[model samples]
Each structure stands twice: as C-alpha cells, then as structure tokens.
Target: MIFFRSLLVAMLVILSAYTAVVVGNHGMNLLTVFFADMAAIEWPGQFNLDFMFMLALSALWVLWRQGISLSGIGLALCAFFGGALFLSCYLLVLSVQTNGDVRKMLLGRHMPAHS
Candidate 1:
C-alpha cells in the first residue's frame, strides 16, 4: 500500500511537471494538434489513438466503480479528458478514503462491513 501510494504520487508529480512544460511550449491547443496528427496518419497519431482508447477504458472503470451514478458520469468525463492528471489525484484520495485497502480502492466499498 505504501509502495502504491508512493508510485501514485511520483506519477502525479512527473506528469504534472511534463504537462506544464508541454502546455507552456505548445499553448492550450491540444485538441487541434491531437486530431491533426490522426488525420496525418503518422506514428504520433497512432500513439494518440491508442492512448485515447486507454483513457476511455479508465473512464469506464471509474464509472463502474462509482456504480454509474450521475456523479460517476461526471467523473468519467474528467477521467477521459484529464487522463492521468485526474486519475492520480483520484487514486490518492481513494487511498485515504479506503485507509490503504487495495481491494476497496480497486473495487470500491460496494457492500457494508460485516459486524
């Protein structure tokens, strides 16, 4: 659990720094460049498409974890667009909420604890 927490924090830090650098250099026109690469039929485009699918999968997982509530749908959207930025933060919060329980973190607290 500690290892997982450390890894999540590290990923969040690294991604945040890298994204800052990228946005600074490229401005906020991510959608245009992302789609343009796909339209050009290049390697970057291929990678982007693969990554997009992964994001979709992440969103689906988040929705399922939340039982597909209205709030879950909102979170799913954030998971899709915010990517790792959203997920890293989300997991960190879940870690705290679940008290480092890996099973609960992954599956959520769907059932009441047996007394």
Candidate 2:
C-alpha cells in the first residue's frame, strides 16, 4: 500500500500543474465553460456531473475526517478545490500512517475496535 505513496504524490503534482495551466490560460472563464457544459445533454456532460458529485463526496469525506475543527474545515476546502489530488494524497498519507491498518485509513481514526 505504501509503495504507491510516491505515485499518489506524483498524481497530486500533475493535477496541480494541470490546474495551474488551465486556470492561467482560461481564468474564470474556465468556470463559465464548466457550468455551461454541466447543463448540456450528452454522455460527457453526465460523466462530468458524476465526477463532480464524487468530488463533492471527497470534500465531505475530508470534512468528516477533520470533524468540526478549523484544520478539518481547511482540509475540506482543500478537498473541494483539489479534488482527486487532495484525496489521493490524503489516502497515501493515511496508508503510510496506519502501517497495515486499512480499516483505520478508510474508516477514519475513530474506527471502532472489533469486539
């Protein structure tokens, strides 16, 4: 699990670079194009919506992970803006953190002990 940690980090770097390039080129019009496509009736449009919903869920998961703390809120915002990049990096960190404890990584720190 930890072996792919660097891969995840690579993905994060790629995503960040992609975002910088896109936003640098398109600016806020990127958002306008995004929403315009959101309203389209096509498979790609639907796929984009589905992907965005997953991103929202990712942000929610970050919020859940952080709880109501300030840092948690900050991370949730990061997840919102960062999408798969943030999520992949988070899981990578978690995988390294818990050793072999998959449950802890996926289910959060408060995962109940098996009785």
Candidate 3:
C-alpha cells in the first residue's frame, strides 16, 4: 500500500508538472480543450469553477490516502518544487487574463511587464 501510494503521488506530480508546462507553453486554450474532453466524459456542463474544485478535491484524496507525512519523500518534493512550478504557471496565466496584481506580488522580480 505504501509503495502504491508513493507511486500515485509521483504520477500526480509528474502529470501536474506536465500540465503546467503545456499550459505555460501553449496557453489556457489547450487546457480548456482538455477540460472540455473531460467534461464530455464525466461532467455535462461547461468547464468552470466546479470542475476545478472537483479536481482539487480528487488530488487531496490521493495525498491523504497515501498516508505519507507532509515531510515525507514524495510530498516534500512535490509540494515544494513540482507544485510550485505548476501553480506559478497557472497563476501567471490568471494574472495575464485578469490583469491581477497579486501575481506580481507572488512572482516578485520574475514577472514580465504587460507591454
């Protein structure tokens, strides 16, 4: 069980990292397309906050069920590096779309100007 859980966490980290890269490189349109496909299968409505919430919940379940401590091997690396990488890219897109200043605050010197 522990091994399985660790494997699951690793897979999630990889998938999230891949998604972050794709979203950063190709843009949210690609994510929207992926979400659309997901919706077609399980969700009938347009992809929105609800779908995102569900995904987050599902991730939480995996994290919890794995029984790995927050300081454990998988969680530490994923939360520190992989999760940060994924969230940074996602927030960047959100900042671009909404012109939100919070992104600048979070990214500090790393953000590109709106020019």
Candidate 4:
C-alpha cells in the first residue's frame, strides 16, 4: 500500500510537470492557469496547496517519530517532487477542460501554420 501510494505520488508529479510545460508553451502562467482551471471544474484551489502541505508535514512527522534526522536531499526531493505532483494534477485537470476531443484531435494535435 505504501509502495502504491508512493508510485501514485510519483506519477502525479510527472503529470503535473507535463501539464505545466504544456500550459507554459501555450502562453499561460502556470500557477494562475492551474488555479483557474481547478476553479472552472468546481475543484477548490486549496486542495492542491493542502495536499502538498500535508505531504511535507507527514514526511517530517515520520522522521521525528522515527528519531531520524532529516537530510537536505530528502527536503529537496519533497519540494521538487511535491511541486511537480501539484502542477501535474492541476495541469491535467485544466487540459481536460480546455482541450476537449475536438481541440485535441485538431488544433492541439497539429503545429500552427506559419504565416
């Protein structure tokens, strides 16, 4: 169960990063786009923030509970992976709303024609 949870977290991070890149390529501010996209779908923006905060807090709590010292690498990974996860989920949701089937099959799938 823990392994699956970790795997899910990793996948979410990758998806979030991909979403951010796609949005950025389309001239959107990653953060604003993420929040707006979530809002449009009736998802609270706080969900993403809260999730990250909880994950970090849980990691810290575990370390403390185990009497383990936190390392810089662990902190870095938490931030990096956590950010990617949040962004990916945000972007994935936004992409679904913005690029429906028609858009995905046509405009989104093709390169823009040069003037």
* Winning candidate number (TM-score): 1
Which tens-of-lDDT digit does each residue in 21-112 have in candidate 4?
88778765656765675677555666766755766764454333324445533644454455556433433543455453434322332424
lDDT for model 3, on a 0 to 1 scale?
0.52
Q: Rate the local accuracy (lDDT) of all candidates.
A: 0.92, 0.78, 0.52, 0.51
lDDT of 1 by residue, 12-79 (tens): 99999999999999999999999999999999999999999999999999998988789999999999
Model 4 misplaced regions, further than 4 Å? 1-17, 20-28, 31-42, 58-77, 80-115
Clashes of each: 0, 0, 0, 4
Q: What is the lDDT of candidate 2?
A: 0.78
Return whichever of 1 and 2 wins on TM-score.
1
Model 3 lowest lDDT segment of ten: 75-84
What's model 2's TM-score? 0.75
Off by over 4 Å in 1: 109-115
Candidate closer to the true structure by TM-score (higher is better), 2 or 3: 2
TM-score, every prediction = 0.91, 0.75, 0.29, 0.31
The prediction achieving the highest lDDT against the true structure is: 1
Q: If ranked by lDDT, best first, what sequence of candidates would result?
A: 1, 2, 3, 4
Which pairs clash (backbone N, Cα, C closer than 3 Å) in model 1? none
| TM-score winner, 1 or 4 | 1
What digit string (tens of lDDT, one per residue) describes model 3 on residues 24-61? 99887855675677667655444544655655654453
